[model samples]
Target: MLTSDQEIRELLTAARTVAVVGISDDPERDSYMVAEFLQRQGYRIIPVNPRLVNLNIQVLGEKPYATLRDVPEKIDIVDIFRRPETVMPVIEDAIAAGAGAVWMQLSIVNKEAAARAEAAGLKVVMNRCMAVEYRRLMPR
Candidate 1:
């Protein structure tokens, strides 16, 4: 697991594409807001939400994929917004999709899932907001 500010900042710097798992179509949601912020900061945001995919809805101008594996593109990071108990499947998908890292949003932490991701050679960041970290570490 990556815990240091320098490590996290380096990961954020190297990352290009992020898959936002469990993202909501509603703009008011934190998931949506963070994804938008990352997008505006020049990171490619791939919204991952099965519900939105089923409804043929787009989030942040990109169609939401059902899962990370369904993205059909290289994903640098998987930004998770789901509950802690539900993170295992997303971690599995991230590993299968060959993602470089998995980031669990604020208040969402699953040590088991983090371990699994790390074992699969993926960096893990738990209980932190990507937008907050980006703003803090990569100030304009």
Candidate 2:
């Protein structure tokens, strides 16, 4: 819903560390591929997935965290890959984790959650693809 290219560019340029919620281990998955691309672009990727924690495995060379609260570093952007119905709790966690921004990936949108995040002073972009936005906004 955030349509300003300048704002999106600013947020993406400012972000250095991204915590990818619901990231997958499978490379074929959109979450995994996007996270990988970000990692390759030098973003510190904090993978957050309960399944990965349950499996006790790392993804993309970083230890997988069960939740945003478990991540030690400051999260510049919390990129969510979960369903719209399940995003409120994740946004709450992102706020608690002190993230600078929240990005709900393509096909995922929660107006209430986005409003809450913005009200809490965190920049938000819902129903957009982070990797695509990065390519579009960041200088190539």
Candidate 3:
């Protein structure tokens, strides 16, 4: 787990793109809202939801991927919104996708997945909101 503010900042700053797993089509959902927020903050957001394949590209600027593996380009950060049980496979996919960091959203935590991602050389940030942290760490 990344402990220092600098480390977290570096990860957030260095990342150019984020793959938002389990992204929802509904704007009311946290997944969609966070993805929108991150996109607004200049993180190229690639929304991922198996259910929203056909509408993905039309909605999200970048074409949405059904799975992380479905993404073509390099993924710097993986923002996951799935359940705990769903995270391990997503982490495996993130490892395979060569993402530098894996961020599990607020109220979400998967210890095994976090440890696994960290062991695979990816920075793991669990139980944190990306938008909130971005606000806290980088004061505009």
Candidate 4:
């Protein structure tokens, strides 16, 4: 079954940290916007992209990891920002990395990948924007 808004909100609220796959350095990208949004909401945002190796520490903080395997802390959620065809490997990596949930960004679709994660005991949320859910569910 596809994840509900309630489930996504619960996951986001409970998750202390999130690893963003396919994160881009370009400020115009949605990935960067979402990452910054989550960070402002008090979630630890770790950028997971191989292309960021050349970036400075102050810019990337902990230096972007090439994959989930390179992340230092336990990942609560793996927010994917890539194409549908590019998400399977990231999902597999999330499971291997011991992530609690897999969140595919808005407009992105990957049912097969979501099912695989669900089967692996990881909560899966697809085709949704986490930032939207957070605002809708936690609008104080």
- Using lDDT as the measure, which candidate wins? 1
State the lDDT of candidate 2 residue by residue for 1-140, as single tens digits.
35799989888878899999999999999999999999989899999998999999889998999999999889999999999999999999999999999999999989999999999999999889999998988987
TM-score of 1: 0.99
Span of 10 residues, lowest total lDDT, candidate 2: 1-10
Residue 109 deviation, candidate 4, in Å?
0.8
Ranking of all predicted structures according to lDDT, beginning with the best and ending with the worst: 1, 2, 3, 4
Off by over 4 Å in 4: 54-60
- TM-scores of the candidates are 0.99, 0.97, 0.93, 0.92
Residue pairs with backbone atoms closer than 3 Å in model 1 (clashes) = none
Residue clash pairs of candidate 4:
none
Task: For candidate 1, write residues 21-117 as lDDT tens digits.
Answer: 9999899999999999999999999999999989999999998999898999999999999999999999999999999999999999899999999
- Count clashing pairs, candidate 3: 0
Question: What RMSD does each model have against the real structure?
Answer: 0.6, 0.9, 1.4, 1.7
Q: What is the lDDT of residue 36 in candidate 3?
A: 89
- Give one digit per residue, the lDDT tens place, for model 3 in 6-28: 98888889998999998887789
Q: For model 4, how does the per-residue alpha-carbon lDDT over 107-133 read when each residue is reduced to its tens digit?
A: 888889988999999988888888888
